[model samples]
Target chain A: MEDRVKRIEKALDHFLPERKGSLSETVTDAMRYSLLNGGKRVRAVLTLAFCELCGGDEDMAMPFACAVEMVHAYSLIHDDLPCMDNDDMRRGKPSNHKFYGENYALLAGDGLLTKAFETALSSEAFRNVGMERAAYAAAVLARCAGEHGMVGGQCIDLATENRTVSLDELCEKDTGKTANLIMAACMMGCIAAGANETQINAAKEYALHIGLAFQIRDDILDVTGDAKELGKNIGVDAQNARCTYVSILGVEKAQALVDEHTEKALHALDAFDADSTFLHEFAEKLATRSK
Target chain B: MEDRVKRIEKALDHFLPERKGSLSETVTDAMRYSLLNGGKRVRAVLTLAFCELCGGDEDMAMPFACAVEMVHAYSLIHDDLPCMDNDDMRRGKPSNHKFYGENYALLAGDGLLTKAFETALSSEAFRNVGMERAAYAAAVLARCAGEHGMVGGQCIDLATENRTVSLDELCEKDTGKTANLIMAACMMGCIAAGANETQINAAKEYALHIGLAFQIRDDILDVTGDAKELGKNIGVDAQNARCTYVSILGVEKAQALVDEHTEKALHALDAFDADSTFLHEFAEKLATRSK
Candidate 1:
């Protein structure tokens, strides 16, 4: 996991614009400051792990992995905007909008999102994946992250704020908001490896299960985790009146859901011939994570 | 021109998500509101005209044309945010943020940008252009819109705000901010048609000239055109303390620059073997138009 994080970090540094460029220093600096702040690199790691498990070249997966992280980072930056989450702190430090004024922070987020595709499209590693597959994968990323997916989920979150939401509504939001990108990561790996449809479908199902499990654990942590370990103010969901797994089902039931989903995630991989020890361990860790 | 506008409108309607879909109604409504609002659709028109001139099927060009407009609309939406340009209206109507609030406005911009690529990638029309060409075209769009192009120009615009800058610096900023996308539209047309490198280069040069001219004319209009004529507030460049062609080089010199660039634009098209009469007329109209 540490090596995976390092690899993702190195690729990100190489892929992002150099700090010395003549472009807007403030925007680029803000972009770098947030992107390189060293999160868990979960999405990138998932991409690489899935690629390796499917017998694809890890080198070919690096660009897509980095691109996923960029998308994730961009989402976070926007999510923390005053007009959005209004978060002053993220990952234990000042949020993007807090650090760079709102204007620069907004443009910085746009820059990161645009750069993700530019990097993905221009990458030699991506070219090695073949244009057809690359286009397909790029399309997947766009669909999963755009209004139809994460953006839509965000809209629903705002629309339902301070309102009681049914479990079904919460599930719909969670699926769109969290599982889409994870599914994209797994699908991208399968595409890069030239995996068959069955393998791709299985991987997607695996991602959905683990993604739900991950989110459930996050909800649990929001109420119980310490601020320092959580790397931001905890109990934000409750304060926002967001309906979460823990809020809807309570902690014990939410934990049970996480366990069931994690088991299903591992079960989804039964069709694959390759060793998936890392993925299994990763899912377990995410399900039981403190932060 | 009216027919071209209608064609662009129809394509956009077909390509954008329906407002009644299950996705967050607010986000999609915001997207449709801003996108379908009666803007000039210049980028899409340029793409279609150039593609037809290059002997590509116009139907096949529609997807890329709509994508270009989506990008343009997204930029306008983001640029009008309170944190950015802070405009209250666009196209004689309430700006996205004014109507939807800043948060939804921000997400709507993101949704449009992401949808641009998704529409491009999923187009059966695009598939007929071939994967390598489609990928190449997509990369061109991203670069023109992303850090290396429009976003970079935006950065410079902000960085140089309230400061005097050289004409060269101003040109560089304009080149990145505006010309890049115009140039991209032309390049994508050529790419779709499988035009040779020289033809593609000529299209780019032509685009750059016209793009700069178009922007210079915009600066002139901002000061002289009525709010009703332009469908938004005028004289904003001076109010914002921003550097523009009209501000840096008075109206006379800015008008002179527009003429020079327009001529240069027509001259660059001499290398192409196509009926360029319409393009010639279009350039003259763009340079001389009141709004």
Candidate 2:
């Protein structure tokens, strides 16, 4: 792994606690379980990469990295709520509601979402960015996390239940529910490090392509990958008859689309002069990952 | 009625439909009823009062005013959930979950909480405050609404179930969950309008007293008031054996405490040269109001 990626991983590990000793033990545990489960920390890695690529300090981007991960984890918790997906397992273990009960799971998700910004605002990294930049970053995070962003996307996804949706519509749903927050993560790093508008826009573009590509790959994985490899139950989407890129485009065409998105993502990165070998390679590998 | 209070109510009615679409009809309608079913609009009114008092334009403070009300509504929704108070009625009508199913009620609460920020950020009022101020206000609102504020207080309250909590501990929980958000509303308005630290601090102090007094009066009302006047059911605290200020201090002592807090709230207004008559009288009247 690259040093920046390693740094993000290390920071995330350091940031999560086994217990906070509050009354919200089950909620905190649910947060810790998903957060610490050994995913690739893709969002944080991308944030660190983009911040470094923009000739900015990675130290200033660490909180943004953690914030993105917390938001991601919280989304996963809510997505698994009985009202939403009714899923029983996540990351190969009992889902939050399964273990914590529905009410605690709900509160836990809400707490994590709120805590992400609190963590971001209180970070030394934020102080380094100054109040204006910190505020800007918070606003960006809020927009992506709130209704017009991730939650809005979730609303659309829920609305599509038992209905056929076109490929464009699927992309629209994925863009908001999954892609927008990821894009916000990358953009937030740039904003936190005080990158120029040019750098920020380029990073945003890169994030948009990669985020969509990531979801497409996820759709592809759901259809073809084994549960052991994906760390999740495969074919669940097919069971739900949920419209996805894979469902609409077929596996072969979905693979092609991932490649096209990877190319587009790299194209956006071309604007940055700083080395982005890690980012470029990350995009390419996202297409090939089994999970 | 105050012009700003009327304006906030008008805006609440206007923005109510901006969020709901047809699909989530049950959940959306429940949210609408709780939000539109009139209360005093006290928190939003406080926000507007602080902004005008601090020499900030009310127009710039209005979106945030709406946001506070939304947050307040969300707290009520969650507080009345089955695992919590399980209140069937609020403001003399069926609570959100009582009309909607429990599951839909949960989602509706989530939807309203998410919409609060979206409404705030998307508003021209927020933009008028400048990005820096808006971001600060957003952060404040998030902290107040999230675990460290209202949600955290609820968690503690739940933990203290079926037991006696000391006056200090009860105060701490009530203050954090209830007063904290109200304080945030006042501070956020001042910050939104670019109030200096001195003005912000004064408003915060005033908010602290009123908020605690409000909760204390609530406990008192629970014991003394009837079902018709207070709306919802009466004597819920006694029925649930909940630990509240009145439960801990007894009715006479709680009433004395409310008076003390109300006087202190008014005294805090003395720090500012601006006409705080509405805010001062508002606090005093809030203490004695029936229903």
Candidate 3:
């Protein structure tokens, strides 16, 4: 991992203590189990990278970085619920439900989602950013996490289960379930950095493109990567009979779409004149990653 | 219902349009279904009343009111999930899961919760109020709804299922699950109305007492009231072996505690001016109600 990503992971660990000895011990435990589980720290790294691209300090973006991770963690937990994807594994270990049981997984997800907002609102750096932008950031996170974004996408994903999905339907599902929060993370980072509306819009465009590319890459990886490489069970999507970008479009077509999105994402970087190297390279790396 | 409450209900209806005209139609429909299931509208009414108490206009409190109800509605929807309470009914009708299916219910709850923050942050009324108070209200609501408050309480409640609980454990559960949001609602109302900290604290105290009293009353009513009046399967707690104050303290003792809490709630109201008649009476009514 990059030093910046490592720093964010360390900060997340420090900031999210177990809340030990509290009534929420179990919830805190489940949240920590998933959050602390080894991952790429991609969202937080992206958040900090975008903030830095806007000349914002990492310290100022810490809470949002943590919040982004919390949101991602919560989504994974919920996505693994019996009524949802019903997966038993994540990150090459037991999923949250596998460890904590289904109900705990649900509550843990709720706790993390709520905690993300609390963290964002209570952070001194966030407060120093002024309420208007903070509120904007908060709203963006909520929209992305909720029905209009991730939740909405998940709902459609469930609706399409065992059913063949057209390419357009699959794209829409990918946009909502996967792309929305990624886009929100980028936009939120910029908003926290006190970027202007134009800058924020550019960041959002970049996020949307990269977010979709990330999903497409995931679809490709599910078909091509080994179970160990992907950190979880392989061909789970096929086992579940779920449609994906790779399912609708062949692997080659999906790869082409990834290229298109990666280019679009880089185009969005053109609007910014700062140290864009990290963000641009990160977008490329995200789209081209094997896992 | 009071005229103001009716007005708020009407406003809630207008706020959530019932239509399925797009690809994301189901999500929008689920949100409307959960949010539009009419309740007492107590939270919104209190917000408006608090705004009025602080010399603010009803219009100024409208968004905050809707936001409160949305949060409340979302909680109920999720709480009714099969993995949670498995409740089939709420407000004397099929629960969100029962009507919309579990997936839709989950997204509906998520949608309502997220839309709530979005509405609060974007409301013209919130902008009219200073950002400080708006942020304060946002923080309070987030905390109340998160682990330390409602969600935490719920976690305990779930853990304690089918276990015999002592009075203290029951109190802790009720405090986290039921009373916390009530207290938050009152505090948010005061903050929205731009009340001083002293007034906010006083309102919180009143809300805390009333909230506990309300739950105790519920426990009492669960044992004593008819199913028709209660609109739920009363004695279901005994059937499920769920720990409740009534099961722990017995009916008469539970009533006595309710009386005590009612007195404390009334005493808390003494700090407020005598002109806050309806708010004070609402507490009394909540304590003494049969259902």
Instruction: Give DockQ for candidates 1 onward, in order.
Output: 0.76, 0.42, 0.69
lDDT of predicted model 1: 0.85
- Where model 3 places Cα greater than 4 Å from the true spot, the runs are none
Chain A TM-score of each candidate structure, as shown: 0.97, 0.94, 0.96
- How do all models score by TM-score? 0.97, 0.90, 0.96
Q: Which digits, one per residue and each the tens of the lDDT, describe model 3 over residues A229-278?
A: 88888787788787888887889999999999999999999999886988
Per model, the share of native interface contacts recovered reads 0.70, 0.37, 0.69
Best prediction by DockQ: 1
Q: Which whole-number lDDT from 0 to 100 does residue A21 have in model 1?
A: 59
Model 3's TM-score against the true structure: 0.96
Residue-wise C-alpha lDDT for candidate 2, range A1-291, written one tens digit per residue: 667666766776666554477654555566677777676788887777777777668777888888888888888887887767889998888888888777677777777776676666654644667656776666677777765567666766766767998787788778877888888889988887788888888888888888889899999989888898777898889898888888788999999999998899989888888778888898899878887
Q: Is the docking of candidate 3 incorrect, acceptable, medium or high quality?
A: medium
- Choose 1 or 3, whichever is better by lDDT: 1
* Model 2: CA > 4 A from native: A2-6, A9-30, A123-126, A196-199, B12-37, B92-94, B97-108, B118-127
CA shift at B10, candidate 1, in angstroms? Answer: 1.3
Sort every candidate by DockQ, greatest first.
1, 3, 2
lDDT of 3 by residue, B1-291 (tens): 478887887777666655465556787787887787767777788778777776677766777788789888989999889888888988788998898888778778777877777666655545667666676777788888888888889888877786677788878888889888887777777887778888888877877777788888887777788887777778777777777778777888887888788788777666666377878778778877977
lDDT per residue, candidate 1, A1-291, as tens digits?
687788788889988857675746677888888899989888888888888888998887887888788888999999999899999999999999898888888888888888877766775645678777777777888888888788888888888886898888887788878888888888788877778889889889999999888888889999989999889999899887788988889999999999999999999888689999988898889888997
**What C-alpha lDDT do the candidate models reach, one value each?**
0.85, 0.78, 0.80
Q: How close to the true structure is residue B32 of candidate 2, measured as C-alpha lDDT?
A: 74
Candidate 1 lDDT, B151-245, residue by residue in tens: 88888888888689888989988998899999988888777777888878888998999999999999999998888888888878888777788
